[model samples]
Target: MLEREELKLYNRQIILPELGLAGQEKLKVARVLMIGAGGLGCPVLQYLVAAGVGHVGIVDADVIDISNLHRQILYSIADVGKPKAETAKQKLEWLNPFVELTAYEERLNTENAARLINLYDLIIDGSDNFTTRYLVNDTCVALNKPLVFGSIFKFEGQVSVFNYQDGPNYRDVFPEPPPENEVPNCDETGVIGVLPGIIGTYMANEAIKIICDIGETLSGKLFSMNALDNSMNVYKITKQRQAISAPVAANLAASPDREISMETLSNWLGETPDEICIIDVRETYEFDDYNIGGLNIPLYELQESVDIIPVDKKLVFICQTGQRSKIALQWTESHLKNEKYSLKNGIKHNL
Candidate 1:
């Protein structure tokens, strides 16, 4: 039973026609785990806490930075340098004192993902990369849990619910992981601050519908939104293959040392001269905004222009964030298997 103060605290939500007392009660008992405390996580966390989600777990290993203030609205300039997850937990606790907020000030990786996710009823993914995105998807599928998904790029965003009651999962739509470096992150490519907010709210809405058992769930549909046009499109998908292959499983299991932290990358940048061959995979406009000194090659143009890359030099791939760089590196590796190449680390981290 909820205390009188608790009841008073959630009165506005309880009075809603769509979300009545029962809906509020459901939220009170529910446990949710959200990955990432960046742009999308900020809004999702705020509304979920405000709506009285009984227990919420936030996992993020990042510290607040001034650059994050544009979209990660939860943090203030004063909060910069503080651990994002802990700061969010403190703010959430104040928003709904009746709710319990858990903060894991650590990155969500393959080793800890299963254990961390096992404690929750549902998982919300605001993670920025294909690696973490696929990690969460596979883990959620293995546990047979519902996942609220969101991703933003440039002026667009995508939202969906995966692994919900035998619905078409993410794998159904994107059967194979594209060779790394194909997709750039918000930081690498630059996202309008408001974009993640729109996507994050959609993720929160999906969570609410799943919690309350009302409205049409975006189970088999991918919702794409273009901020520039104020347009929304939903593409339905069907299950093509079930049971990921052993090779795919092995790939997931493989811990490649290709990844580096933004801090490590920054350090390397400071120590090394610009003589190394660095390929920046972000769009041209992004090159104009802010970028490390590197050769610009948009992701889509890489395949046709592979000939331009010099064979003798040690190639280092970079992008807005590391996502596209990883893809580009993978593509470069397969095409030039005998060539020597590597990837630069995080674009947003330490920046």
Candidate 2:
């Protein structure tokens, strides 16, 4: 039941023939727990609160960083250094007093995953890492809760509904988490600030649809969009005979000295450009699509002392994941004795 004030606050949306009063009421009582109060979480919380979602929970251990101002619209310079979950709740409470907000200022980890997940009627995975993504999906499957998932890479974003009414869970679409460094994150690759807003709102819309039991949700569909090209796609998701739980890839567990961190590599590139050579082993198409300034030498075509190996420049092999780059190094091991390494976790990061 909505208060007289809530009815007025949401009158515009309430009047929609498809939504009406019944839908508004459903929103006023829906309990939603969103993971990650970063880029994606900001817009989602704002829309859900303003739209009168009655009970909302936020879980984020990260404090506001100055870099977050671009996409985390709910925060400002003044809010920097504050806990995201708490700051969001305090501000969102003012957005709609009719909605109850709770903040858990902590990361969602294995120990606390099940407990926190069980508290909500639905889950919106605003998390940015592959580990958390799979953990959230598995827990949702265990607890029988619907999960609305969204992720943003450099210029593209993906959204889908998992474990909805026994629909294909996340595992069915991505049965395994990509290697830790296979896909670089926004921090490493960068995203246009407005991209998250566009994608996050789509996620919130999915949540509203679920809570109100209206419209066809992306229960068994994957929605992907490229902000750079302004293209969108919706692909049907097929469930596997049994959901396969994927282990977090240990592709980065190689010897410490044998691998390089992106930060160190970036610092080296900036300070001593002549000292480092980043050899991207991904295919020509992949490297052409995106690369962080590196030579494009397809792994399949790699050869010893390939095209006069520079003796002065330290070699760093890179690929989608660190695994293929390792192969590239082995192929060149005998002929090239220059200090070489496989980029720790590859060029792009999933998280």
Would you estimate the TM-scores of all the predictions? 0.69, 0.69
- lDDT value, residue 271 of candidate 2: 97
Clashing pairs in 2: 183-348, 183-349, 183-350, 184-348, 184-349
Stretches > 4 Å off in candidate 1? 243-351
**Candidate 1 per-residue C-alpha lDDT over 85-136 given as tens digits, one digit per residue, 9 for 90 to 100:** 9999998887888889999999886557767887899999999878788778
> C-alpha displacement of 216 in model 2, angstroms?
0.9
Clashing residue pairs in candidate 1 (N, C-alpha, C atoms within 3 angstroms): 179-327, 180-326, 180-327, 180-328, 181-324, 181-326, 181-327, 181-328, 188-320, 188-321
Q: Model 2, 190: alpha-carbon shift in Å?
A: 0.4
What is the Cα-based lDDT of residue 125 in candidate 1? 97
Predicted candidate 2 versus true structure: per-residue lDDT over 1-351, tens digit per residue = 778888899999999999999999889878999999999999999999999999999999999999999889999999999999999999999888888999999888655776788789999999989878967886776557799999998889999999988789887887557756596887788988998899999999999999988999999999999999999999999976343221222121235687788888888889999898888877677788789877887654565327755777899988876755765564456557788888877876722
CA lDDT scores, all candidates in order: 0.78, 0.82
In the order shown, the candidates' Cα RMSDs to the true structure are: 11.3, 13.1
Where is the poorest 10-residue window by lDDT in model 2?
244-253
